[model samples]
Target: MDMNTTPVLQLTGICKRFAGIVALNNVALSVRAGEVMALIGENGAGKSTLVKTLTGIYRPDEGTIELAGQPVRFANAQDAMQAGVTAVHQETVMFDELTVAENIYVGRQPCRGASGRIDWSKIEAEAEKLFERLEVALPVRARVKDLSVAQRHFVEIARALSQDARVVILDEPTASLSQREIRELYRIIRQLRDAGTAVIFISHKFDEIYEVADRYTVLRDGQFIAEGALADITEQELVALMVGRTVKQAYPKADVTPGEVLLSVENLCHPTEFDNVSFELRRGEILGFYGLVGAGRSEVMQALFGLSTQVRGNVRLDGKPVCVTCAADAIKHGIAYVPEDRQHQGAHLTLPILQNITLPILSKVGFFLRGRRAEENKIARHFAEQLELKAAYLTQNVSELSGGNQQKVVLGKWLATNPKVIILDEPTKGIDIGSKAAVHRFIGELVSKGLSVILVSSELPEVMGLADRIVVMHQGRIEHTFNRGEATPEMIVSAASGNELAEDCA
Candidate 1:
């Protein structure tokens, strides 16, 4: 990979404004061929907007994009793809019913000479060649819906290569991949770089950025902060640039002793999702659930929250047996769940912050309010302050907030219910380092106030740092449980991958 060559893609003085809110202001980025540039930023740091601008999804209010030493303006995503610039997003947008080969050449398939009919054999051959180049194997005739997440990503990459793309953008590609799959993706990225493809890698994990990226570009609050060789800076320094300040402790675990058991589950079974899942959440304790992508961590939590059907379990709250058959039942039993997919399940994006916060408690507060607007405001304001929520006003919609602030609103909404037990599934999955710190502190505060927490996270470090007890799940069953100070990343990951360790059984 050559660093001295002329950049294959460059952006200068890029600015994008939405409804008078500046998303990107004079941001600049340069990506030379045969190099991987890490785009580092927190949630709402203009990374998504910049990606949209680069891909022609959103035209910048002011900027110039240069590809191969020539100015280029993309009228739409198709235009950008034709210009040899393509992006593989985190959640792949592919036709589920289409075959892998068909998806690769869906828009522009090779036609038979003279006849001008679609050449299916040529399409499959070309798709095969693309996967061969990437050193990955897949059945070209397999339907996309039958493929795994990693396979879907490979298909997207194959599509990029099919278009003869010189600049490829990968946005959080490894967020859902397993350890082995991630390693494979890393190898493919290096392959693209060695082939002189300029790659822009976007991720929230610093370790991944440092491991795969040759150079670093930092964006904060819609502006470029710095750009340099990754070797010249430390992770702490990079984090400081992204958040505009140093995060001394990413996980500030408070000292809280576990009290008597607050909630206990015995033989919780979700039939297909999970089975025989049993755990106890003590008052003032954070019980962590660690697992790989399909380890049934979230499934178990959903069942506990009464969001799953045909779930058979004996649940006891505060020493008394309880039955929770629905979400309302869970809420009535003092259980609140903040789901992982905040956008779809956890938050009502179209609703105002005030309404979203007080939604669950509307019955308790009188649904109509009856001129109790001040009381509604009072409730919303109290939790907002507690969560340190960042919003212009309570009337503002949740859709207007950043990922971190939106998660805060969800937290505030559930906290408003005053539940004795809260289930936070992947609470800080996509937020930045600063927002993660804030959330970790809040979790600590929750425990200190005698609130029991069930933290379902795929991040090993987070679970180990914040959990009093870590439960490892694999293949829809509990593999092992580790008390705090006794669990290591190796042990947790090993158990998560279904390779239970003998030494950690205790």
Candidate 2:
């Protein structure tokens, strides 16, 4: 971890453009060996594009890339890998059926001397060595699909190390990991740094950045804002650089007194998922569900939305019993759900924004009999405008939009359904502070209009800020419920971590 040595990887005047949109403009970055350089930016801040360029996924329209004091131009990902530059993405790509060792050496397996046959034993031994080096205990013979999320990440890292990667880029590696898993990952990162590997850590969590990074690089709107030692700047200053302005209020929640109960669940149970879950949602109320990753918060929401078939519960809407057997039934009951995985469950990436937004209400738009484009546009435009979606046109593909804009599209689509009870799961996950504030404001406006919202989020600040009532879940049951004024971070966290002081706080 020498500071005086030359950077192992360097980029100068990097510019990347896509279909007339400038994704990265004159961005410069340098990563010295044996250091963890954190790449911090808001969503759509050109971080992904820069990483793509670095990995040869997308060639920069203009730039100079240097590796080990020599100019290098990678033709493709394989070319970059050969040059000792590799990236382990958030959504890991590996053959689920393959063994951990097989996946680690899939295409690059060592051949038996003179025999030209695959060397399986060597591969397993090598994977074992890599795991040992990372101080992680993982079976080399275990199937990839059988591994946990954290173990899968370890396999990805092992694969990168197998390629002898000097510059390893980790893209949002901790997004879905638990606190303990995150700590393990940090230890592995430090190990890599100590071994003289330049680690590029990309994340939105400021606490993680402060804890792990040795240096910081900020990107905003496709340009480099600043770079300095991590110890030289404060969190607020870093946030300001990423968003181009100080966020006056990260949570712009408006005060609203909830009215009569709109929806109530009694003894909701899903065999192996959650058990005996019960809650009430009042009119114009935002009820927040806070829990750890495996606390079964999302499972409860899924069951309530009719996505789980084995769910047993008594749901009363407006004091009347309602049975929702499927998503269609849930929709018919005036309950709309924005799923946690926006990319997979929320919106169709290949479809246009307008089409995605109008998908839920196609029949309402006369699409069953004779679809009217005008009607679809009108409905899509109304919600799109309301959500302030930033898109070039209604016909633009959702895949082309940024993470924040993609989330807005998902919200706009569900809002078009005009549901009385809307369930938003991790609504602002992976979005920037500015987008988060905008979403909070929108939620406030919705509740002001008498719309009841059920918010499920892993983020404590978001739940505390927007929820009028906080419901903490652990394992598979509701452990505690607290009114807005009564909840504290410590209590909520303790409950979420399965250390609830009481059986029921309510």
Candidate 3:
């Protein structure tokens, strides 16, 4: 093994296939000591498969993995870790029932005090020491379920650090974290790097990458397209490489003005989900609800759309009261919702795109046997073109398109209903910048067309840049509301975190 020249980990010509789909072909990456290598690609572009292969979750069909310049084959996750390779994924899984100390030291538990029982006191003390070292607030005895999502994520990171591995892989590490939490995570990562640990950061956030990554590796269509010093590449170039194409404009602004009040809610109260929620959505206005997870943003939207049972509110459409108790009622009132997790809830994977796209408006059609197919195709193609869907035809399976395109299909399905108000929940999750630009553009256009839009997004930039008026929520309560030129990212994020705003202007 070459001490000065050997990479910490070297992957050469990696190739993997899944059900006749060539997921990875001729992909290569080399990770050095004390450097953070960012692995970025579009969804289903083989980033997960590549990491799985490296961690022994999946074996590459062809390629060689060299650790310290010596070829090694990892039989399992444990084996990979033993060889100094550890991965902390997007979903951090641990025993909710286990104590923090036990969760951190799972496989190799600390010795008991000759009683053959787990040394609870020793475990707690050690856990406290680790938390202190990282400057993270965590109770060793606290139940995992009692902690917040961000806290649980930190616990997962603690477990990874406990492994004493030379290389760490983080997938979407900051997805659910607040800006403050993200800074803390970055601090810990830098601490790890300073300890000579090589970090592999995988995230869709461009700013986070530029701030932390030492090098950038871009993968597209399961193949390594570009790798360069992070400082050498511009953000635009990086985006282009990940998408493998040129992206035009984002925020496709359409010329629009308020036609009328499309939907108005007067003194809405769902005691369980929300209380005294009052708002009005005018035509061609995008009112974005900005809040941290569990701030009751989604719940309020759901209540208005008839998804919540305990909702008591006056929902009016065009100066007339409307009843909403279920999805059918919402549809009847010309309200469409593109939910979060489009794959899980919005699309039928086994069914073709046409079926999913038409499911919302299925009952409206007379089903003339002669022109049914042509009519369906025309409708699907029209919106698909508007969305710039990646698939070739309307009959293609929704499961085949990228994450961005799948989301577009979900929007298309709802758009088929000719809704007066559209509610989009985390509409751009797991999507690339190119696709994100497309979606922002589409939303701008839809709002311009006198379609009221209630957008729930975790991305601060999305909400701050696109929303006409921003409503900030904190702990199931409306903390503040900001009109145009007032709602900045700093204020929204601060308010969402339950902190007092510097300038309290509701």
Candidate 4:
């Protein structure tokens, strides 16, 4: 690829505002043909707004957009697609009842003749060709709902290519994918670049940015900060640019002494999810669950939290047997769960921050009685301060907050329950690095105050840095266990990938 070639897409002085908030302020970016440009920033740093503007979901309040040296203005998303710009979002939106081939050629299906009858055979053949070009094996006749998350993403890409897209934007594409799926997606991205399509890869994971992107662009607080080659920049430097300061310790794990067992699971089994998962979480301990995608880590946690009815296990709390059949039962037994899907399961996006925080404790707030607003506000304020949540007011809807702040609200709600044991499944999954550090510090504080926690994460560094003891899961079973001093990235990766379990570690 010629570095001096004209950019396939370019945006200069892009500015967008929503009422009082400035989303993108004079942001600029350019992507050359056959080159991968990484668009990176912290949450609320205007990455999403910029992407929406580029894709014509939001007309920029101010900016000049050019494609191949020609200025263009898109009226809407369809217009952008017609102009050869398309996006594949993180959460794929498709008709679940439609077949894969239909989804690939949904709005612009081929017509047979003057009668305008749909050409099903042509659509299927084109879908197959697209998959073959990307080196993906997927059946065109399969229903969209029946496909895996990775497969759905591939279908989205195929749809984009079928629309004659010259510039392809992928927003957080690997967030839900497994290690293998991520590698395959990377391969497909490289193929697109080789075919001379301008690729914009947006992600928070620095490793992925370094692995797949040829050049990098940084955005901060709705402003373009820098642009440079990936090889010329360091990870620390990139973090500094995104956060406006250096993050010395990404994992702020504190030293705490473990106490007597608080909760114990004995031969816990779920018919199709996980089997014979036994572990003991001690007071003042952060027990980490490490696994790849589909390793049953989240499933076992959900079962322990009484979210699964097919679970068969004996749970003991504080040396006494306990039965938790539902979420209410789990809360009653002093257990709280922060689910992985924060947007759906963790926090109520439509509710105010105060209401979300005080949701689980409504019973104590005198639900039947009036005039409890002060109490609710006080409790919400306390936890919000503890988590360092940034918001204009407690009355602000959670949907208005950034991803990190919303996650904090989720943690706040569970903390307000006053449980002895808390389960956090991918707590820092989508939030930025600064928020991750804050959450890690908060976890350390919780354990220091005699609380026990089950930390389930796919990131190896997170588990290795914060966990006093790490448990590796594979195929719904516990494969290995390691103390903080004994575990290494290599051992955890080996166990997570289905290598032979180490008897000694177990």
Give per-residue CA lDDT, model 4, range 196-271, as digits (tens).
9999998889899999999999999889999999999999999999999999987878788899999999999989
Clashes of 3: 1
Q: Please report the candidate that would top lDDT against the real structure.
A: 4
Measured against the true structure, the TM-scores of the candidates, in listed sequence, are 0.92, 0.96, 0.83, 0.96
**True lDDT of residue 384, candidate 1:** 88
lDDT comparing candidate 4 with the true structure: 0.92
Candidate 2 lDDT at 420 equals 96
Report the CA-based lDDT of candidate 2 relative to the real structure.
0.90
Off by over 4 Å in 2: 1-4, 368-371, 500-506
Candidate 1: Cα lDDT at 98: 95
Off by over 4 Å in 1: 113-116, 350-355, 362-385, 390-401, 494-506
Candidate 4 segments exceeding 4 Å error: 366-369, 498-501, 504-506
lDDT of 1 by residue, 183-236 (tens): 999999999999989999999998899889999999998999999999999998
Candidate 3 residue runs with Cα over 4 Å from true position? 1-4, 107-129, 245-248, 272-274, 291-295, 340-406, 416-418, 448-450, 458-460, 471-506
- Model 2, 359-404: lDDT tens digits are 9888787765655778878888887888777777899999988788
Clashing pairs in 1: none
Query: Which has the higher TM-score value, candidate number 1 or candidate number 2?
Result: 2
Q: Write out the backbone clash pairs for model 4.
A: none
